[model samples]
Target: MAEEEAVKLFGTWRSPFSRRVEIALKLKGVDFKYYEEDLTNKSHLLLKYNPVHKKIPVLVHNEKPIVESLVILEYIDETWKEGFPILPKDPCQRSHARFWARFLDEKCLPAIEEACLRSVDREKAVEEACELLKLLENELKDNKFFGGETIGLVDIVASVISCWLKAFQQVAGVELLTKEKLPKLCEWSDEFVSHAVIKGCLPPSDKLLASLRAHFETVASKELCT
Candidate 1:
């Protein structure tokens, strides 16, 4: 693709969904322009492109918009299918990859979001969060990555969990994915984040922690004063 024909990604720094697309682009060695969107006041282009959900992490290829992080991931893979494959070539392995990716979306992502955003029952939320982490720990026990030895589709999806989990731990004042509790999963996270592409795409840990602290405090104060 020529310089003008290159892709353009609309996203936010803190959004893990956006980060997924960013990492995929870097992994595939695709040239693209990044446009960060402010969720508070979303840009006209974002609204115009994704009018339905009006969400970030929209990828524009040749000016055609693709929404949803996972959907965009599949699109990226298919578009540059020749390069480093994110999804496996074998039919069974590809199905397994999709299963885990969907699992992260259906189960893991929601649990983390609830733990971070909902404050009606703080203790219950933290407990539920730990349960989800335990399930992940079991799934990751023997596998180096969700796709086995190398990082793949499911690995990318699961990687988002760490960022949110870290935020939750800071806000709730509890450590769930510790060395002693979920050793392998914790180790996997350490290795996953160490990848140059993923590491460069992630937001600063301190900044994410501070944002989570402020968000939880705001939610907690509002609930108490109400």
Candidate 2:
């Protein structure tokens, strides 16, 4: 008889990166034990598994650990091979998806975070963010999702913008993603979050908002002390 494959995930609820791993695992229909790590006092298992980065969203499969959310997402897609595909099968489409996913992480997310959270030179930050978002808006033109009719790699990577951005904007009193400014992106966000797989995986909006509010307050207090 074959031995059962053991799967475990170390993550935190408030982290979008952590949420990304959960979404991928659930999407691929992989059953995994979840260990919620305290960011302030990280677990020993987390440290042991991810010695280098010491980050959350570490996926352990049959004792082999995978770090980095994007890497884990790809790993999950490749390993499972039973559920709906995460990345497109065609080489060209796969490359395009990878490019956009990287863009979401490296370019769009940072710009949006700065625009929503910046305490200095707010105008310039918002302007830059808006410009970047316009590019995304154009990319999403007329498609129900970045993955056309269904959710895919780009949508998964951009989940932070769809869900976390709302809390960020509320806490910072900034409205970076709006229906008026970027209608297509706004619509995409709405539809993205509404999906059955995504809706359950995301943190509750009210709880998330309160947490961000407390976090920003703590940061402000520390800055004032400094």
Candidate 3:
């Protein structure tokens, strides 16, 4: 790929989904220039490229825009088939990887956030999140990483658990992932954050804590006043 080919990524600084694509590109040795979009004031280019969802973490390669982080990850893997393939080679394992990735994004992350926020249905939220997390814990029991020995697509998608979840847990003043309760999951989180490519982009705990605390307070005030 020529320098002028200009792989451009539109994303926010703290977004794990964006980081997923970014890390995938780096792992594949693809050079990309990043545009940090202010989510408060989304860019016209982002709107033009990803009109339907109008979301950040859009990947523009060779003047083509790919929306949704998971889809973008697959695109990156297939396009640059040179190093560290994200998905497994076997058909069955590939499907399993995709399934778990979707499960984390669509199910586990939401439940975990809801449990942390405890905004409504607190008990149900906590139970649901714990159940999902237990499944993940079992998967990680015999493996070093979600992908066995190294970080893969599922590991990339699960990155939020290591960084954002810790920040959110503190801000929400909740105790969901304790070292004793979820030791394996906690261990995986620590390992993930300590990994080289992931460590660089992991958000500062203090920064996220402040931001999330302010956001929760604002939301809480709105709820109380209403």
Candidate 4:
């Protein structure tokens, strides 16, 4: 790709979905311009590009818009399949990887959201979240990454869990990824965040914590009032 090849990314820094595409692009050595969208007052370009979702993390390659983080991820992998392949090539292995990725996206992510953002039953929410984390820890015990040795499809989807888990821990005043209880999971998190691409894509820890704290306070106050 030429330096002048038009590749633009519309995303929000705070969104994990957006961060996934950003990290994938960086890892694949794709040169692109990033436009941070204020979701409240979304830009005309964003709406025009992704008319369906009006969401961030829309990748424009050669002026073609690709919406949805997972879709964009697969697009990136296919477009730049030669270098830094995010999905495995083997059919059976790839299917298994996709299954785990979908599991995290569907089951694990919703559980975390309910625990941290919506559920009135805090204890039950925590228990549900812990169960999900326990499952993840068990999965990682025998593999260095979700793809065994290298970070792949499942790892990317699972990355959302780690980011939210950290922020939720701070806001919920709980420790789930403990060194003693989930040593491997904690280690996997450490390794994932330490990766150059992920490290660069993540928002500053202080900023993320402050944002999460503010959100939690607002939600808790609303619950108390009702």
Q: Over the full model, what C-alpha lDDT does candidate 2 score relative to the true structure?
A: 0.88
Candidate 3 whole-model C-alpha lDDT, 0 to 1: 0.86
Candidate 1 collision pairs? none
lDDT of each: 0.82, 0.88, 0.86, 0.82
When 1 and 2 are scored with TM-score, the better candidate is 2
Summarize candidate 3's per-residue lDDT along 6-92 as a digit string, tens digits. 799999877889888888888788888899999889999999999999998999988899999999999998888888889888889
Shift of residue 93 alpha carbon in model 4, Å:
1.1
1-226: candidate 1 lDDT, tens digit per residue: 6943569999998888899898888888888999989999999999988999999889998888999998999899989977778999899988878887887789877876776677567568757877877877787768788767888898788777656677676677666677887788888898898888888888898898888788788888988998
Candidate 4 global lDDT = 0.82
Query: How much is 204 displaced in model 4, in angstroms?
Result: 0.1
> For residues 82-171, could you state the per-residue lDDT of candidate 4 as single tens digits?
789898899898787777777788888888777777656767886887788788778776778987788887778777766767887777
User: What number of clashing residue pairs does each candidate have, in the order they appear?
Assistant: 0, 0, 0, 0
In model 4, what is the error at residue 6, expressed in angstroms?
A: 1.6
* Model 4: how far residue 217 lies from native, Å: 2.2
- List the pairs of residues colliding in candidate 3: none
lDDT of the structure predicted as candidate 1: 0.82
Model 3, runs deviating above 4 Å: 1-5
The 10-residue segment of model 2 with minimum total lDDT is: 1-10
The true-versus-predicted C-alpha distance at residue 163 of model 3, in Å, is 0.6
lDDT score of residue 65 within candidate 4:
95
